[model samples]
Target chain A: MPEPVEIGRLTFTEAEIRRFAGAFDPQGFHVDPEAARQSPFGGLVASGWHVVCAWMGAFVRAHPSAADSPVDHPSVIAPVGVGFGLQGLEWKAPVRAGDTLVFFTQVLEARASGSRPGWSVFHRRNSARREDGVEVMAFELRHMAPDPAPGRG
Target chain B: MPDFFYEDFVVGEVKAFGSHTITEEEIVTFAREFDPQPMHTDAAAGAKSVLGGLSASGWHSCAIMMRLICDGFLLRTAGMGSPGVTENSWLAPVRPGDVLTLRRTVLEARTSKSRPEMGLVTFKFELVKADKTVAVSQTCLIMIGRRNPGARLA
Candidate 1:
């Protein structure tokens, strides 16, 4: 592995928000500038899932460790499942289209599956903060990553 | 495809079903296109590094779910798009040969206070495996027609 990757602060402009919203989540709070003013957020906002996706994009782009790693082209590991019953995601505030978002992700753990060889388990933890200097979203993403050394997945 | 109008939706309703499998070819294709991680691309690389073996990307799964919903239920539905989703839950790992399925519950439905011709339908979606293990879950919001087929926002 190259090194741990860290994505700096990322802000959102109204136009980018509108574009992303219009494509995947065109709705009252995302597509229309005026319509969003009436929602609980008081302005246009991005979807939490989308926010996570965006953070992933930026994080990968900014992290030299991930960028320099000998990872697969598309991706090597896919998440097997998510524990909804045990998740600790809290959308503290709506991500308005105009505000910026930032995140910090680190490799938490890597364990080879005892039941399945040639398949290891990789875990990553992401902490997202809003532009106002507040941590807004956090998640522990577990996937499959490979080990460069022998006998260690 | 039949148009699913607003009137066809009901709160507390659940739809259980399945999707296509996640194959090695698809994992590589998606990884190469967007994720490019060792686990998602090379089985050996993934096996050696962290995940132990080949895996899929989370976004790829989300995109697959979108396609499934659009084809299985949302196509030609007399409904507007969504603002977005929240509280996505992936309960288990999906692998090759795994047949993806879904179980969705209609959580809420109400006519828009301002947009008289349209109504919003909110649902909680659960993705599962053939063995009935919950793989992924999420809450989705969609707008549907009240009565008119051509009801739209201007």
Candidate 2:
């Protein structure tokens, strides 16, 4: 099994949150820092979806565009799908602007597709929390990694 | 954006429309900007990975649904916004060459006593493929203009 990768810690700047919230969300807690401070979250909070995005990046170890990334590898490739089971997703604590959070990724499994011509699954659990050790939000994402021949030996 | 008064949107109503053509380009573009996972960004890597082949990002599907809403429903109506979505689920994978249509059913509509210009409207969103496959579905809550006589214009 490939060693589980620890994507390490990253911080959320209020500006990043504002940028995402403005065009996509535009909600008071997401886009307006001053207003977010007064909300129950007690400060500017990263959008729940933003947290998921960061976690996905961490789980993969390298960015998709990295030179060594499989995406850049020779075999024909592409993702079939990504499923987020919201049943267990939790927004435990609000992630605030400037708060550093580390991401932990555990590779649950890797298997060759039995049904289709090119199919496979890379199951990963992505978790993130604050530098102060507070769990904020997280979710498990399952990504489809399709390859030419069955290669999950 | 005319306020979509409570009286305007009736429950059990279904609105169908969209311009989302599931292009590998649009899919990759969205996944790169919003998701950027290995499977989403690289086609070759995805072939080697477990999901076997290329799949569309779930968020990409949802975002496209959002854009369709803006074009068909939201822009023509005054909308406040939804508190959030609950029980959101993506039932199937969407891929390139897929064409999707949004079918929205007005589940419920009610005047908010405290908010004079708006009423809450709940909808069920379904993304159907060209082959009549239901690829994704979810529930959404939106703030819309109300037509109630007692409702004030926002």
Candidate 3:
């Protein structure tokens, strides 16, 4: 119905990139700046995984209910749902240090779950783009939420 | 480092990686900063929900898989970068205290028609729990360098 909501914005820094890389994805091009410069990217580039992780962080912070909420426990504007699956994940472009990204998510569909009597499944399309508007990553996330309709469950 | 290039990956070869045990603390911490759904952050709420108990977010599972892959082989391989993911499915929920391991199979390998210095390798990845239950399955492509001494991209 409405245009996709703008979730949040994030800028990648070398240190942040390396910190994530060191912990989860320590590829040479991801961890060593000098080695990365000599690698195919010609400089340090955030791992696709790192970009996805940062996107999650930004998405959570910018969530509608996250306003004025504490970092650990935010106001529950909507019921938390179970993550089911993801579809069509495309890392279209490289994310380098210093590049800022904007995130967005749009609800695609929501229907009652036949297997889970009290729950509804929602499909959401999400994307992250650079300041230049080049897309870095896109995907469809499927999750299940409690049915909101009164007496429906 | 010796060239573990495009030639090294053989079709049908399945490689298993290290494992990580999911913990309740990490699940709540990650969900608090990322997914933050009640089922993930609130234990009592989660237990009352369909999941029956607290569970790890699917994205958290992806991060764990990536860690195992990096530690298993990507760190020492002649890897370029991946174009994107074609398929990613979470078949089962990952709960705290579950030990998960990653298994990868070389599904396809072909030289890049446009970039001679590199090749494309498609892999089938799965996250299997301690009881041999697969929680997540993914198929994706990676760009890898060739073995030729003068074929380095940088």
- Best-fitting candidate, measured by lDDT? 3
lDDT (C-alpha, whole model) for all candidates: 0.61, 0.64, 0.80
DockQ of each: 0.14, 0.21, 0.49
Best by TM-score: 3
**Candidate 1's DockQ:** 0.14
Report the first chain's TM-score for all candidates: 0.69, 0.72, 0.81
Error of 1 at B86 (Å): 2.1
What range of 10 consecutive residues in model 1 chain A has the weakest lDDT sum? A74-83
lDDT of 1 by residue, A8-57 (tens): 66677778767655544455666677867765457777755567657655
- For candidate 2, the chain B TM-score comes to 0.88
> Residue-pair clashes per candidate, as listed?
51, 33, 0
Over A1-153, each residue of candidate 2 has an lDDT whose tens digit, in order, gives 555455767778988887765544555667777867664445677766567666654544443333433444323233233464333455566777888888876668767756644556666655777877677765455555545323422
Give the winner by DockQ.
3
TM-score computed on alpha carbons, candidate 1: 0.57
* Candidate 3 TM-score on chain B: 0.93
Cα deviation of A17, candidate 2, in Å: 7.1
List the lowest-lDDT window of 10 residues for candidate 2 chain A: A72-81
